[model samples]
Target: MAAPRAVIVHRTSELTELLARHGTRGQVSFFLEQRGQSLAAVEERHDRTRAALADVTAGLPVDWRRASVERGELARSVFEPDDVILVVGQDGLVANAAKYLGAQPVIGIDPLPGVNAGILVPHAPAEGGALAEAARTGAAPLCERTMVRVRTDDGQSLTALNEVMIGQPGHQSARYTLDVDGRSERQSSSGVIVGTGTGATGWCSSIARVQSPRLALPAPTDRGLAWFVREPWPSPSTGADLLAGLLHGDAVQLRVESDQLVAFGDGMEDDRLTLSWGQRVRIEVADRTLRTVRSVR
Candidate 1:
């Protein structure tokens, strides 16, 4: 039987060299690129990648391919189940590649070493271990980190890796009704965030100071939701009741007079949801979860 194919992804100059060194030791490697970005930036990254590759594969009998998945057919051809895709730099490419191929085992590489690779895989726990089952058996669990389902007021459902933020697109403050689990509260702020563990470090982190609770499940504990209230009116003070209610999956309702309000997930702009004053914005815990590959040490 042939050894499983391991595709090594790289970006920065130094890391590419590291991958080349690792690849010569029996690992199958490939180079992946994105569609749109500054050419100067791309050339710079590419040059760095080549230099790294040269250093690592100095005397090895190796062949590397610059596979561009620009076209639809090309993308389909690059992503296959038998391939174990490894992303070396950022998670953007890996995330995009997963959309094309659902069965491939995608892993993130930690360039700095000791740093958390944060490699999210499409695996779930079962018999044996999640990692073993994923590597040898190719058994895909029902739940994956990419399994996010969000329902909007427009009767549309969406998914994202990061937190969903609610904000108004104008200078005027967005007055919204926040409903957590079952209770409701009025809010007038720049925006509100409904985030998951995966997105806690992003927008959620930016808005407030969130510490990873040492507990088994590190749910975000907010002292109180912050509202960016314009001068003249006092800032909306999120009380303990609101904080407790939000943590427990209470649905929040937000109402605004203007239709300039917007709902964003993972920092992307979602369609304008039709809502009225005192319209309830439901914020609750989701059943779906993200599966991440962690380091042994």
Candidate 2:
């Protein structure tokens, strides 16, 4: 059996990226100033994030195996059954990490405590140590959040804690035949987003808001999913009648007619699947859930 491991998942601060791109602090300051921004604000946020990380690092038990992964490296990171994930960034970071995890419990540590949005990342950084210990000892309460999965006929699959967007590149309309329940329709639309209850609050909610009655979304704990087709174009050969619906105990299938299309989750564009014409894809609620700590204290 693998030893209990604690994985710290964090995103690179914007200031750090700016410094790397501009080659120096002065250059970064100059670049930001040109855009009417202040370097001080960015630096302050960076310092606070780093301080949070330091406290969390200091709190880890010496006997526990430890590792850290940046946001960009999450898709490539391997997670074990006994691992405990400490997400020390925004709530979105939890979403980015959730798809890769199995049953391992996650602790969301907001680098900035008071300003917390109380979404996914809800804990203060100071609680990292005790939380990990509690999780390892099986004393931590767990909450399950629903997720969605998309699989291609080629044997490739992707999971999302939020939603999966399958579309053509560069705003070009995507051509595909969509299948739901027993009905099917040929569609020419911007894309399709199949989302879970957790995703219903973000992109899915915004997308549904544009509808007349505003589509109802599933709850974070619900196994069902809600999906939408963006701006389905109406024409002689195509139909927009099947634009929105729910997925419960059923999978939504799409066969691509476009030359190229891609599917990505949670706005992580770099990690995506590229599909070709004549490819078939299946989307449904996933078997795996994002297991998170129930309480922050």
Candidate 3:
């Protein structure tokens, strides 16, 4: 048997990013002042995040092996099945790390606590140690959150904990042949989005609300997904018949009719799949679920 490891996944704080962006802390402070935002707030958050991460690291069992990685480095980090993932930050960070993971249990620790909607990150920094032990022993309660996957014809696939967006990079009109449940049609629109129940509150909800206000989207732990086509354009060659619907036991398929198209997950544009003309992409509910560890304290 392999030794259980604790993996702390985090991201550079806003202050840190600002410093890198402006080349100095002094410049970052001036930049925030111009926007009527005080640098103190950002500094406080940065400190909180660092302290929380330190606490999580210190709380791990003395005998357990540990490793840490920033959110941007997740794609490059190799994870083991026995690793307990500790995500220290807002809920979005947990979602960001989800696509790079498999079945490992994730413990979301909110450093700022009530500042952000703590859906994915339900635990606080204080419970880090208990959460670690619970997850390691498989005694922690888990919410098996569903996810979405987009696969290209050439065997490339990407999973998103929130939703998968397929269209042009800046969301220009995307031309494609929409296929669902064996029916197909040529359509032109902003693009397509397939989201899991976990994505409901994010980009999926913002669009779903306007497209289908009466539609009931799946809950966090639900099995189904809500999908929608953005601002479908109707022309002589294209029809906007299929606007939106709930997906369960079925997947949305698209064939690129334009010169080029791209598929990205969870708002990650840089990391995406490029599809040329005559290519096909399939959007479906992913088989892998994000197992989030609940608070054991």
List TM-scores for all candidates, in order: 0.51, 0.95, 0.96
Whole-model Cα lDDT per candidate?
0.42, 0.90, 0.89
User: Model 1: what TM-score?
Assistant: 0.51
If both were scored by TM-score, which would come out higher, candidate 1 or candidate 2? 2
Supply the global lDDT for candidate 3.
0.89
Ranking by TM-score: 3, 2, 1
Off by over 4 Å in 2: 1-3, 114-116
Task: Candidate 1: count the clashes.
Answer: 22
lDDT by residue (190-241, candidate 1, tens digit) is 5665555454444444444432232222232331222212211235543223
The parts of candidate 3 lying over 4 Å away from their true place are: none
- The full ranking of all candidates by lDDT, starting with the best, is 2, 3, 1
**What value does the lDDT take at residue 268 in candidate 2?**
85
Off by over 4 Å in 1: 1-88, 91-105, 110-136, 139-149, 170-172, 210-257, 270-281
